[model samples]
Each structure stands twice: as structure tokens, then as C-alpha cells.
Target chain A: MAAVDHDRAAQVGAQPLDVKAIRSDFPILDVEVNGRRLVYLDSASSSQKPRQVLDAMTRYYETTHANVHRGVYAIAEEATRQFEEARAKLARLVNARSAREIVFTKNVTEAINLVAHSWGRRNLTAGDAVLLTEMEHHANLVPWLMLAEERGIELRYIRLTADGQLDLSDLDRLVDGVKLVGVTCMSNVLGTINPVAELAEAAHSAGALFLADAAQYVPHLATDIQQLGCDFLGFTGHKMLGPTGIGCLWAREDLLEEMPPFLGGGEMISDVRLDGFLPADVPWKFEAGTPPIAEAIGLGAAVDYLTGLGMDAVRRHEVELTSYALCKLAADHPDLVIYGPADPASRGGVISLALGDIHAHDLSQVLDTAGVCVRAGHHCAKPLMRHLGVTATARASFYVYNDESDVDALSEALAEARKFFG
Target chain B: MPGLEDLYREIILDHYRNPRNRGELECPPAHRYEGFNPLCGDEIVLYLDVRDEKVVDLKIAGQGCSISQSSASMMSSAVKGKTLDEARALLRAFKAMMSIHEARLDAEDRELGANGQGADGEEAPPMGDLEALQGVVKFPVRIKCATLAWNTLAQGLDGANGSAGPS
Candidate 1:
């Protein structure tokens, strides 16, 4: 896969990403930890929210705080509009044909579970397979595994290559009896950005529905459901600089309409006559009970913020920083084993490193004292860790707010950790 | 003080670099159990040999962070050649040091003097080299890493009391 060349894209129509100005938008970046300036490098776990997103949620709570659909009052109607408008904004962000196709859930985990339990249980039968890559997070893998166990279907895995990319050499055989092709758009560990459109095409040609776990991809890159041609794209709001407890599952409207409600409760039903209940419309049918109203509004604002900054600029900044980090880290620590593509062009800003004889937790702890926040674990992808022949790696993921200085802090902290551990 | 230097004490690092009694014990008269932190994928497989209600031999084998591996190493040395009851007491003392359940530090304060010193009071027993892990208390998250081997050994002792398979 070729590097995206997002720098060119940013230069074309978008203003150059001003990281210093962007840093000001996130207040938490100013915090101090262990008497050291905070250098947050854990965006893959969750991105920090900007004041725009925070203010939007607070404003919604302060002014318009009422339940939707059932209440016919003025505030209720206002709340309903804001909530639906949030859906429209999210739909627009992903280029979904209709807002009705977007289903709000707790997080990407729930979104994937919604599709697996609601659509999967109904459509898939015994002997059918859900093809997944080895690099899938537990959020994408466990839900499908549960479905496979209950429905008596096969769960096949696509092998990973030596360089940490998905080895699609046996695509024909792997997709033979597979009903669903579930894969991550980008590896949280390896930082390998996958060819989502190409994979979706392969799934379609093999008569399987493609579900791309865009939890990692949607935050760092520009997402277009139409361009990707995926049947379903699951992403969390928190990873995109919005609050937790909100995520979007964008599926084809017809598919959502055909699928039954995942959870049976209020707002999801149109008429309940003691014996049987009629489900609500497409997206609402999936979102049962009290929805994450404020969270959705906040997510809408987050989408707006990203749009204002331009995703191409965000990507360009990340690519430049990642390239610099790769070079800087390589030059500084010759013994350090950084995973994923050596070329920052081939990967996102996530850099997973294994220093010689130094445990990731130790590195993380040492770095923590230096006020460098990094993820030091299997990153919810144990199989991928095993594939990489490592117990864990200290992961540093970049976002819109992260700058070159943050990477320098991480590097310096890593050096300190190495020396201290030795 | 709750410092990184205190947490990664020289004694802890020594044990981590050269873990004591790290290998598999023969199956006969040996009870093996595995412990996993799961959060960081730190695993410890404890092999215990009990004879006449005493742990005559013990070995720890697995891969993990320095804290876990060092704790396991220290645990093997701390418990080896001790009666099951004595080992349990040491385990209790270690857990108390970690203040597992957020228990009052009064008891730990009495045991560990102001600056990683030994007990001044008679009621609190000095935890010795285990006192090096007193710094681990500041890092609540790494407490699990420091306790994996001891917990696994505890489970293995229970298995010995119940099944004692192939003995």
C-alpha cells in the first residue's frame, strides 16, 4: 500500500495545521504530572476533548435537557432536534447517504456487538464463517466469537505477514464460506493503515458483508463510507476528541431497516400490544431507551471542530511528526525495535517500541514519572502481540494536538527509562 | 518517597535481571499453577514442591514486566523451604505491604519506618527484602504485578491440599 500523501491534500484546499494553536484548544494538555509537564501520547486509547466539544455538551445540558420522541413539549422537541442534528452531522462526517443509517451506541464495542447480535444472529447460520484479521481488537473479535459460539458458525482468521500487514494471499480460500469480513481499518499496535476500500471490494466480490472497525482510522484519517464501500463502519466518539459513552455505527439504511432491534426497550418501539411490539424506524430501532443526548451533541461539535481544522491537515501534521519520530527514535536508540512500517508514509502516528531487555510497563512507569503518558500493554490485541513475538510494547499515538516536542519528550523519557532499568 | 527510583530499587532490578529459581520443576511432587495480570499480559507460572506440608522447592517461569518478574523472583526466595503456613503468613505480610483493598497504612507505617526502614514497633514484623517493594504501594496499578507469583503459589497450595494430583 502506498503512503496516503495527506500533505499534498492539506496544501491543496486546507490551511496548514497550526499545532500550537490547536494545542490551546485542549486544556488538559497544560496539566502537570509528577512535577513534569504532561506529554500525552495515548490518543489511540482516547483523544483529549477540545473546548468546543466540552462547551457544546455543557450548553446542551444547561439549556435543552429533555427526553426525545415521547415528550411533546417545547424543550423535548428542541432536544429531539439537537439529537437528530447530531446524527446528521455524524452521517455527514462519514458521507453516509442518510442520517437514519447512523445508530448511536455506548462505544465501538457496543456498535460491533449491535451488528453481531442483531444482524448476525438473524442472518448467519451453522457452518457460516466470520472472517477476521489477526490484528482485531477484543471489541471486534469477542462479539463475533460469541455469535459464532451461539449460532454454531465458524470464525476464521486472516493471517498477518512478517511486516505486520494483513497477508491476504489466501483471500479466496479465507472468504469462501465467510458471511462477514470483519477487520480494523488501522492496527492499534502495528500502526498499519489497511486498504479498507480494497478489502471491502474483496468481501463484496466474495458475497460477504464487510464491517470495518474504524475506531482507530476515523480519528486520524478522513472517512467516507461511500468511497470505502463498506457495509458497516464502527467508530467511537471518544477517539475522535468527543466524550465517552457515545459512538456511531454507520450501516446501509436498508440493512439497518431489515435488522431487528438489539435491545428491547422504550423509544425503540412504536406500538406495544402486550403480546407483540412494533419496532421504531431504522436508526432509532437500534438505539433503545434514553440515548446519549449530550454526548451526541458533543460528538457533533467534535465533528465540526475536525472539519474546521481539516482532516487532511491533521493527517499531514501526523505524517510529518511520525516521520520525524521514526527517524529521531532510530537515530537516538539504535537498539530500539519500533514496530509497524519504517516509513511514516505507510503508517499513522502510532509508534510501538520495544527497547532491548526493557519491559514496556517499566518503560511506561519511568516515562510516567517524566510526565509522558503512553500505553504499555498488548493494547487489547494479544494475538497481534504474539505475532510480533513481544509480550507488550510501549505505544505512543499522536493526534491533532500532539507536536514534535511531545515526541521529543517521549524519546527522552524512553532514554531515561532504559538507563534507569539498566 | 513515592518516586520512580524507589519503585525500581536496585534489589528489584537485580532480581529482575537475574530471576531466582526460574525454571520448570519436575511434575512428580510438584504442583504448577498460572497467574496472569491480563491488563498488561504479564504471566507467571508457579511450580511448587511440597513435602510434609512445607514448600521444599519452588520455581517461577513466565514473561512479564520487571516489577512482576522481580516480585516473582523475590517471592520464590522469600517462600522457599518454608512451611505452607509460614509461606501464607509471608504472603499476608506482602499483601498487607501492598495494602490490597486500600487498607489503612497505619500497620504498614509501623512495619516500614518513615524512609523504607525496618519496623520500630514490636507488633509489626519487618518484611525484610520485601520492604523494597514498599515503594510499589505508590503505584496501585503495579501492585498486581508484585503479587502475581504469590497469588499463583497460594492457589497451588490449595490445589495441593485438595487434589495433589499424581502424588
Candidate 2:
């Protein structure tokens, strides 16, 4: 599969993504679904892992499997070193100030929950507001909602514009008295890339902390905590070609030190007496139990993979593919109603669409027969779905391995679906 | 490996295209029940008018995929003037056709099982147009969509019967 166009790469001025080589790395991309080649477009839900990531985990378990942090044995110390190395890799990936700023979590959901439970409960009280956005995934929204329920705090949202971008017109009013403002760096469904740095500036000017939900952004874009100017950021491993059960929460060290521990268990406490226990230092205090050690190692490998193929190159490839898809879908299927920003430069690689009178589930079902995997339904953003005036949208999200051929296949399948339904 | 044709049979597509008993009935005499397939966000809103053990009329209003909407349409047409007992029998027959009971069977037994039997140990009533949805059983994720309307009807019937004093 000579998928990358070298001629076009020259025009872009960035090193072209060797999509053929990248696809070879992911074993599942070669799999056939329904006697057709699999076209995985559901990376936003969870990305397919590369052999490197899988091999890294397998190698860890086979050679250096042991409980981390507590054990003084040889393998255990090696395991601890590897785990901390993974943390350092993640810290470097996002350009955090120190490795101590990175806290390992089950996934992005657990990371946000940690903040809501530990930092939120301590800082927030009744009548205090936490501002969020309309396009937030439930992972970012639910934790704050739960906090609101428990502490009687108010929740406000930065509304979405007609074009699907965050409507910052009301930011001044919305962020007025809020203790913290949380927003997704990119929308999972709409593919809207938000202006995190600007929002972070607004949040700070209003004397509020800002948290960026980078579950979608970190994998597709070049990210920097300093550039984003966020107080806290959360992202998952699975969406970045890493194994599941591992995520990261990178918070400013000072803020982390001030907050109490989220989950009270081993590996998080300095000393446990019958009366009470003293919590450990910043990062470890938030990591409660024997962590997902091998998963962290795999995530480290994923970071290494992404870094080797520069993030800038990956972003350029996605933008180009997204532009092609948008044009192809529009030209071929005029009835197709696409959701999100019209410009490919303004969004990530996710494309959510609705065809005339066809429900998203039915569309997805038809796409499945052609071996194109897409996500259907509310996408766990029912509030955003309601805002879009739709029950659901079929979303096809691209990743590093996807190319123009996949988009062509998607268009062909969509045409088949329309004819079949008619 | 059932083909798309099996799941989207002509009869099912017909009902989906021209749904029967769509829209709401006035509520003073009608009982409303809603069913939701939270997995896919498919909603079924059913309005039932029951009088003297008979379902006089019913209407359905909701949004979903072909399986759900067509199933709801067929259900409305099938049970418009039937007795509550007859409607329940049809519901049981349709669910059996969908292999609802087989889902609960232990894995080993399920592999060897024939068609699911109704609770009464009697033969299931003939499932007329509802048989078109039999293909849904192969697509397990869509079973909820095919049964959403029937389940809502059951709820409406139960609520109507329960609200009316002992007959």
C-alpha cells in the first residue's frame, strides 16, 4: 500500500507521514471484515494499538513483571524505574515542568474525577460555579456534575456557535465568578478544535483555574502545557495507540501539592496508622493502588512512536486527509449534512455526518457491511446532540494510519448506503 | 453472516417508509409510555387506549433506526383493535422470534437450544409481519431496537391494567 503521496508532501513543506509503513505497524489494519479490508475510522473511541506498543507490554510482563514503588527486589526496582520512565516520557510529550506533575490514572474519566473529588471538594463550596463547554465529552462533564450535586456548586457552560466552535462571546459573563473552567481541547463528535490558550488566558484573568480535557487533542496535535497555559490537563492512553487502563493527569506541581489525595489506598500514603495515614507526595498521592504498570510502559512506547514520526507531520497528514474527505463527501453526496467547522484547519480528523432521512445507526450498519467502522449514537455527548438538533451522528475519525484510500472507501460505502436505503 | 437484505427486508422497509399509527392520541383517554434504548439513544413513545380489556387504539411517536421504527409501525398496525390478552400473546411471540429467552440460557445450552419457548409452555402465536424482524436476532446489538415498541406497549398495557381497579 503506497498510500503516501510524495509529490503532495513536497508542497506541504513538512515530512510526509509514511502511512503505508504506519499501517503495517498496526496488525489489525490488515484484517478483513465481512470479506473486505477493514477501514477503521473509530480512532476517537479507541485507537488500534501498534505492534510496538503490544510488544513493549509483553516484554515488560515476560522479563520485568513486579509490583512497583514498594518492592526493593531487583525486578520490582526495574519495574518502578520503567513506570517512572513512562511518566517522564508523558511529561516530555506534553512539555510539563516536571515528571512529578504527571499522575497515572485508569483513563481520562478517572483523571477528571480525581480533580473534582480532591481539588474540587477542597476549593469549591456551595454557590461556587465551575464553567464548562457545550461540546464536552461526558468524561469532562459528569465529574463536575457529580461535584455540583454533592457540594451544591453551580455549573455554567460556554455555549457553542452556529459553526460548532466554542462561543467565547459570553466568556466574560460565564467565567465571572467561577472557581474553575474546564473545556475539551477538541470535540470528540464535532471535531472542533477549541482555542485552549485563549480560554486559559480568560480563565486566569478571571481568577479561575483552567483544565484542558486533551483526550482528543493530545493524540492528533502537537501539544505543550506552557503554550496551552492550563492549570491541569487530562488525556487517555487508549486513544493514542496505547493499551487501555492507563491515562495521565498533568497538573501544576503547586496545585497538586495543595490538594488532598483522591483515592485512599496503598502506594498513595506515606504512613498508615490506625488513626489515619499521611498522604504521599504530589503525583503518587493521586495514584492509589498498584497501578497499571505494563500499560504505562506501553503508553511510553506509544509516545516514543509518535515522537519518532513527528507530531507536526501527523497533524499535517490528518488535516490533508480531512480536507479530502470533506470535499469528497460534499461533491459526491450533496445531501450529506456534515457537522462541525467547514475548514479542515479549524478541526481535528473527526467527521460526523447525517444523510437525508437516514438515522445514524442505520447508516453505521450499512457502513459496517463494507468494513468501514464508525461510531453511531449520541457519542456520550447528549447535551451536544440536543444542541445539534439530532439524536445521533455517525462519526468517522482518522488516525495516523488512515489515508486518502480509506476516505475514498468511506465515500463509496456511503453512496451504497443511500442507494440501499432508497 | 446474515446479509443486509435479511435485516432490512422489504416489509420492514415498507413500514419504515410509511409508518402506521404514527403521531400521538389525545391523553385524557390514552395512557402514554416511553421506552428508551440507552445504548443507541433510540426512543419510543407509545400512547395506548384501553377500554374493557380491549386495546381500542394506539399510536407511536419516536425517532430511531429502521429496525425500531419499522417494528413500532408493524406493532401499531398488528395490535390496533386486539384484546389486551391477544396483544400480550403477540408480544410474547415476537420476543420469542427474536430469541429473547435464549439470551438468558447458559452459554453451552444456548449453543444446543432450538427456538425459545413462551412462558406458558404453549406454542407461540403466529408472528405475521413481525417475522421480518427475525433477522435482527443475528445482529444482537440491534435486538433492543426491534423490541423497543413492544416493550413500551407492554408497559402501557400493564400501567393501564394496574391503574384500573381489579376487573
Candidate 3:
């Protein structure tokens, strides 16, 4: 199961990941920029796609390209089979109960908006509440805000502790009237790996539904919806070495069945009468119009590639690398202020840093000149930035393909940038 | 290395470390406007006090990167006592210099010398210390940081003119 217990994996003593072979699979690592080898540390923004995923997409377009589900011809049947097979792959990766529970959208943002519109609009009323956290990305926050504005619902927030973890001391009071609790399984900016199971339990005890934004979590960790026990999970493919324009939203079968269709269009409809129309079945009801067919197949190939390497090994590698980075950065750059948990075990590989008196923009530019790509901005979480008392920070995230050498390059670049600025 | 040195010249850092013409001018008479670089969240507020068609005073207040803050500081000094038309001309010259062509700028710098005066006494370059920002053209992303103040000043000048023709 993707969401297998972490304690179990730790007990077994996870093996070191083979990053040398993994780097061979991603051709972009070979490119040079600004007379230096590309040291891509911006995986949190988007991971580079591997050859397997790219080949799958190209193969689909080259041979098996057709409009799925509608045509009964040979090529059409093949296309539909490939598309549904990809859905099943995703379901397996996330330990979803069935492929029918998965709704494909443009990206995680659209998936969240789908749930907010289809379920939130139907279930929520004035004076009802939606509970979110301070660390949620704009994708998770804005949709619920829009719904609240239109439906006159109240919105509550779970605050963050000084150390960047969620402060849940007041959870019982905050969840009193909340109809739904939407939160990120991992903080994209802070790199805090939230306890999704605990949150789900809290939401369930309060008689509320829980939606986990797994955009950052699913890529770096093994995820199982059943074990996590969340009612809804949304994640994007691009952040996990798959192509862009494809994302997944998994919901419990019964909840999806009861929800109204999100968009009125060709694929999501069973019958169209001038007076009224019949919506399609559970997953298709949310998937409107022609979908990203090739991209979906690419995502399936990405799942296969990740599964081949094993998610447990991947997580172990990231944890080890993150620990190394935290130590290396702190020892070398004492003046740098790092955001998020001090203990690497409580976070993913994402690390956001505020260097002494230097703007994140300038730091990123200096890093770029040395071919070290790092993201420097609000990271789409302006509220979190405000909470941290800073406008922006330089973030360098790692992935399965990244090793300690990458961290060394990042540290070296930071030293160079500091000297250059001074 | 040479490119970096050109972009972060000592004078620009001096202005960034010690800005000039910063703070508020008594308004109701002083026209003010604000601008922001949405890409990087850089902001600038420009203040212009015009008396008899000339910019009698200029001030800036904002926080941003070295490029933006230093550019604003230099811009305030450059246009403090110029006429509205001359200030707009300086803005145009600054923007033109910030545009592409790094090699040409280097050549222009060598040909015109440090004083920015042509050997043949044609016309002095409009931008003074603001010319140090010409190296910003190398970085496509930082161009907005260098131009936030000028754009705000332009808007302030427009407001000042529209109200009572520089009262």
C-alpha cells in the first residue's frame, strides 16, 4: 500500500536508494546552463519527467491516439483501454478502493475546485463552516473562500505553532460547527509532514468530511487513502515526475455518487434533453469534456517507474538527504534562518531559507548564475509568508533523483552568492 | 564574472545601503503614486512636489531588493529638480538603458567615459547615477525591480499635471 505505516518501514531498516541509476532515467540532468551542470533543486515546483513517462506519452500520440469511450473502432477501443488502465494504475498507487473513485482534472487546483463546487455547493449552507489550516497553498484556500463568499458559509483556520507545525490545542473548539476540514498532507513551503490520519480522525469525530491536499505528500511519500482514512485526496501528476495537465482527485465511492456533476459537457453526461440532462457515473460526472489522454498514460508510466524503485526506498533516500542538507546548511551558513521543523524526520525534503539581509530574489539569481535552480518567492502561500514575518524565502527541494552531491552544489552556491553580495 | 561585476557595481550597492531622498513630503500639495512588480512582490511609492512646472522635490518609500530600492534611490536623486518634461525624458533614457544589449552598453560606457559625456559635446546622457543600473538588462527577471520606481514616478507626474499643471 502506498500509505503503508511509516513505523513498519522504519522497523525493517529501509535500504539506501540507488540514485546513480535513477539519474540515468532523467535526461534533463545532463543539460548544462550558464557554463555549469544543471543542479535542479526546485522539484517542489515541478519534478523533471523521466524517459519512461515521456516515451509513454510519445507512444500514445504516435500510435494509439483516438477519442476515448465514444468510438467503438479498433484504435478507439485501445485508447479507452489505455486510459482506464492508467486510472487503475493511479488507484493502485494511492490504494484507492476502485478506479471509478478517481476523477481526472487539469491539475490539483482544478481537482480542489471540483470538490468545492460539486460537494461544497450542495452540502454547505449559510452559517455552516469550513475549517482549513494556516499552511495551505492558495489552491486549497481560494476555492473554499469563493464557496464561502457565494454560499455565506463561515471559514475557520487551524493555526500554526512557532516551529511551523500545526497547533492543534484548540482543534475541538475550532471544529465545532465545521462541515468540512481541508488541509495539506504536507506543507509546501514549510516542508512539515502533517499527520493526515490524526486530522481525518478529528474531522470524522466532529462529523465533518476531510480533504487532504496531497500535492506535495504523494510525490515524496507512499500514500494509501484507506489507511489515511481521508474522505478526499487531491494530487497533481507533474509534481511526481509525470507530465503536466493531469491530476487526480480520489473520493469515497458513496460521497462521489451522491455529489452533483461538476461540469456539464459531453463526456460527463449520459443523456441531454432540452429540459434536463442526466449526469454520467461517479468519476466521469466530475471529468468534463475531452481529458488529457496522453498525459494520463504518461502518469501511469510514471507510477510504474516509481513503483519499480519502491516508494519506501524513495522516502528513505529523501529523509537521509534532507537530514544531510539541514546539517550541511546550518554548519556552513550560520547566519541563514531556515523555516519549518528543526527535526528533519518531521518534514519532507523541502527546505526554505532566509539568508542574512539578502532578498530571496537576489539569492535565487546568484544561484541561477551558478546553474543551481531554486525557487524564491511567496511559494503560493502568502498567508504563510505573512505568518513567518517575511515576504519570501529561497526554497530548495529534493527528490528521488537528487543525492548529496546536489546538496553540496547548493551549499557551495550559497557560499559563492554570499561572497558575491558582500 | 565580468557580467556579475557590471550588474552589482559598487555605486548601486552604496545607494542600496544608503538611500537618498527617502521619506514623505508634505502632501495635499505633493502628488503620490504607487507601483508594484507582481512577479516578485517588489513595490515602490513615488512622491513628487511640483512648483511652477518643475519637480521641486521627490521622495521614495518602499522595501524591495537591491535593484529596486537602489534604483528608486538613484531615480529620486536624478529627477529632484528637473522640469516635468526633463524628468520624463530621464525616465525614457533609464528605461532605454535597461533594455537589452549588454555588449553595446559596455561599448557605450567605454566610448562615453565615466562622466557619461560624449567627447564631441553633443548632449549629456539624461540618467546620472541611475546609469549604473544599465547592467540590469542582463537579467530578464530583474528588469521589473529596476523599473518599479520610474513607473510610479511617471504616474505621480501625470497626476500632478492633471490636477493644476504643476501647482
Candidate 4:
């Protein structure tokens, strides 16, 4: 599919998205919530799957349903081909060095856990520091914390500035002796995009590996893993218009070859002797049990759908939408406090805001009445939540399907919430 | 499918706006217990003063949604002067009310041969303003918020009784 026209986009910093056409692909978008049109602003949590993805999974099940890599039958071979084909599509999506570098896990949480268990256990020891940022989702932080507790490894964090961007001023000092640096490319709560390339450079200069938690990045922006220069990257499918139960971890092929297998099971083993077992090759070694075959096929279809929409266009639409939302909320509700970089260009579509003295849960409840779906609470970033001096924030995130009207709806709902609570 | 009015009753909002017994009590005389709704980061700290087998006084210290905050406020007012046995009875009644829909859900799931138990029958005691929170039953996700303070209070009472020995 051709990319969105860049010449027109350059003039306004964004191409106008075909939002009506995009909304038509998602059947759930047509459903009414609370007798109102569903204004889905929770894509940052998990994106709504399109008909393309759903139909792809249904088609695969109807014709190609069989266990992969084990059976020699025709249907089994066809299933294996489709499964591996999905891996190649995912690899192309992120511009990974090779398809072998992509290891399928349950979700981003499992992907991070794979690294913490395999690479972390082999390399980290007592007092060996693994640096991370404070704005990471619990998916990124907890795995390292668990490794730190078990292996006596020290964990360090890159601080967040008052405006919610990562404070990399102390990067040189913090990464001095770190063995690995794990950072999110985007803050799931604050919508602040971190300088991944620069952080990767600092980690490499300090003889440490860098891992990019791209759960929020890959779904919204055009991702080029080579440009990002991270040794390991993790992201989930569910948050990227794909099915749940599938995620990808793209590591350098050499690194995956060196790291031990994450889980011990049938598919991951080459031969299971009475005394010991030989692990399978890199990607397959990481995938132990029966994979989510349908989910993988659905994810491939999701990739095709996004590639057709063009990630640049997707990013542009969100940037424009985010800017509109910021201005609209600020002009309408002076009491609304938005967390993250003030400039919309410096962030993704996530907009976490707090109204005057109102709890996030209460605000979200009121918004639900208006059929505006926003996520409320810590947003899996409790430490960042503490740093912001707020217990929780009602977050309304945008995607390709969202537009200025959605922002207007959110503004109107906020007004209702204020009147209801005030 | 229930409306906002079902989840946020006027009485609940009033309790949230002007929370009764909102603060911390002295630790020496008060037994403290904390509860957390990990799902939403809602925390409730209960400071209970149980003396001579009665809830002599109590205070709440924490922040959360209206359901949790107001539920905690009403809970403080309800059990402030009640005997330990009476307070336990109220806790049982309140929990039963809150779990009514959850129990029905479990029953439905069980009919599909899922692993779930049916709701046990329990007589409900008279609950005054606390009844306003019955609306929370319609919103399953917020039920934990409504019950946070009560759970914390139960823990504090259990600790007090354990420390006081057969009180």
C-alpha cells in the first residue's frame, strides 16, 4: 500500500487521517455504550481488532488448523508455513535483522521476563547494576526487580523531570558500571517519548546492553529497530490492533544464540535424554510449548493492516489529535492538569490528566456515562505516579480511529463530570 | 448496563464530599490496618480503637474513588459505637449485599460447568446509609473499592482481638 502523501503532511506536520474509513474496519466501534456512541480512547491499553485481523484468524482455523513443526501431513505443513510466515511479517514490521531474532512470547511481560531469566541470570551477579527508567510500565520494572531480588543485582533508575520527560542529565554517572539499561521508548502514563537512540548510545559507551520496552512505541509510530540501536526490544500484539496471547521480543541474533532457553518443554528441545537435553535453535528454543497459532496469524494480518495504513500516517494522525486534545482540554477545563511534555510532538497520543481534586476513578466513571472510554489509575506506573504526586490520572489516549470530535466528546464529558461531582 | 446513578448515589457522593472520621488516630491506642486495590492503586488505612469488646472509635486515612472513600466514611460512622459482635454482623451483611451479583455471576458460570461455587445464604442485618453503596454491586470492578475499608477494618479488629486475647 502507498504511504500517505508526505508533501501535504509536511505543511501541517500531519496528514489528515481517513478516520471514518478506519472506524468502519472495527466492528466494535459501531456499538453503543450507555446509550451513547462509543468514543474509544483506550487504545493505549489495548487496541480494538479490525475485521481484517479477525477474518484472517477465522480463515486460518477453517483451512489450516494443525500443530506446527511436528506433523508431516499436508495441513500440518501448511500450518507451519503460515506460522513461520507470521514471524517473518512481524520481523519486517520492526525491521529486525532477521526473522530468527524474533521470539514469540505470551505478551510484553513475558518477553521481559524471558530476558530477566535467561540473559540476566547468566550475566548479572551481586552488585551488578541494571539501569531502568522510572516511567516504565510494571511489565518493564517488576521483572528486573524480581531478578534484582533473586540475584542480588542492584537496580538504578533514570529520573523524570518535573514536566514528565526522562531526566537523562545524570545518564553518564548512572550508567557508569551498569550491565544493562532497560528503558521504555514511550511512557504509558505520561505519553513522554524517551530518547531511545541516545540512551542506547550511552549504554553502549558504558559497555552495557540496552533493551527498549517498545510496547507503546511500535503501535503508534513507524519503528526501525536498526535506527533505535537497541540490543533487545519487547512489545505486545494486543496493544497494536492485534490479538491477545501473542507478543514479540526482537533481540540481536547473536545474543539469542548465547542466552539460555527460557522455558523447558517439548518444542524447545532438540533431544531429551534421560540425564540431559539439547535445546533447539534460537527462536524456537525460546518458544517452548504449543504456540498461539491463530493469534499469530491474526497478528500477521494486523501487521498487514497497519502497513497498509502506513505508520507515518498513523503517527501523524495521533500527533495532530493529541495537539487538538491538549488545546481543547486546556481551553475548556482550566483546572485540568495534564502530565507529560507540553508539546504534542514530544509525545505519543496518551493524555493523562487530572481535574481539580477529583479522583481518577471517579472521573472515569463519569466519562463512562458519556461513552468516552478512558483508563483510570496508576496505569501500571506506580513509581511514576508517586513522582507526579498524584495517586492516579484519568488517561484518554488516541489512535487512528480517534479524531477531533472524540476530543470534543471528552471535553463535554469532563464538563458533565465536573457538574456531577462539584 | 446500569447507569451512573446506580453506581454513584447522592448519599454516596455526600459521604465522599464530607467524609466522616477522616484522619489518623494515635497508634498507641489505635490498631492500624491497610488495604490496597492493586487494580486501581486505591489504598485505605484503617485506624481502629477497640476497647471492652466494642469499637470505641475509628478514623480513615487514605485516598481513592468516591465509592471507596464514601464507603469508608459510611463504614466509620456505622461501626464507631457498635459492639464488636454487632460490627462483625454489619460487615457480613454489607459483604453479602455487595457479593449478591458476584454470586449470581458465579452461579451462571457454574451452569456452564466452570469451577465455581454457589452463593451461600446469609441473613442480612439492618444497614442504614450503607445501603446506598448497594448500587456498587452493579459495577463489579468498583466492588473492591467499596469493600476496601471494610476489609481493612476487619483485619484491624482481628488483630486487636488476637492481641487482646479472647476479647
Largest DockQ belongs to which candidate?
A: 2
Residue A212, candidate 3: C-alpha displacement in angstroms: 0.9
Give per-residue CA lDDT, model 1, range A230-339, as digits (tens). Answer: 99999999999999999989999999989989999998988899899999988888888999899999999999999888788788778888988999999999999999
Candidate 3 chain A weakest ten by summed lDDT: A1-10
Show where candidate 1 strays beyond 4 Å.
A1-13, B100-126, B163-167
Please give, for residues A1-422, the per-residue lDDT of candidate 3 as tens digits. 22337635833766777899899999999999888999999999999999999999999999989999899898899999999999999999999989998999888999899999999989999999999999999999999899888999999999999999999999999988689999998999999988889888889999999999999998888888988989999999999999999999999999999999988888999899999999989789888899999999999999999888887778888888999999999999999899999987778899999889899998998888889999998899988988998877899999998999999999999998899876
In lDDT terms, which candidate is top? 2
Q: Give lDDT tens digits, candidate 4, residues A1-422.
A: 01122213523554566999999999999999989999999999999999999999999999989999999999999999999999999999999989999999999999999999999999999999999999999999999999888989999999988899888888899999999999998899988888888889899999999999999989988788888889999999999999999999999999999999999998999999899999999899999999999999899999999989887788888878888899999999999999899988788899999999889999999999899999998999999999998889999999888889999999999999999888
lDDT of 1 by residue, B1-167 (tens): 37887788899989988999999998886878999988999999999999887889999999999889999999999889988767766766676678655353467655555443334432434467788988888888998889888788879878767764444
Order the numbered candidates by lDDT, best leading: 2, 4, 3, 1
- Candidate 2, lDDT over the whole model: 0.90
Please state what fraction of the native interface contacts candidate 1 reproduces.
0.89
User: For all the predictions, what are the DockQ values?
Assistant: 0.68, 0.78, 0.38, 0.69
Which 10 successive residues of model 4 chain B have the least lDDT summed? B113-122
Clashing pairs in 4: none
Q: Candidate 2 on A1-422: residue-level lDDT in tens?
A: 00123213423667889999999999998899999999999999999999999999999999999999978899999999999999999999999999999999999998999999999999999999999999999999999999888999999998988999888877899999899999998899999888888889999999999999999989988788987899999999999999999999999999999999998899999999999899999899998889999999999999999999988788888888999999999999999999999988778899999999899999999999999999999999999999999898999999999999999999999999999996
What C-alpha lDDT do the candidate models reach, one value each?
Answer: 0.87, 0.90, 0.87, 0.89
Superposed model 4: Cα runs more than 4 Å off: A1-15, B101-124
Interface RMSD of 3: 2.1
> Against the true structure, what is each candidate's TM-score?
0.94, 0.95, 0.92, 0.94
User: Rank order by DockQ, top first?
Assistant: 2, 4, 1, 3
- TM-score of model 3 relative to the true fold? 0.92
True contacts kept of each: 0.89, 0.78, 0.37, 0.81
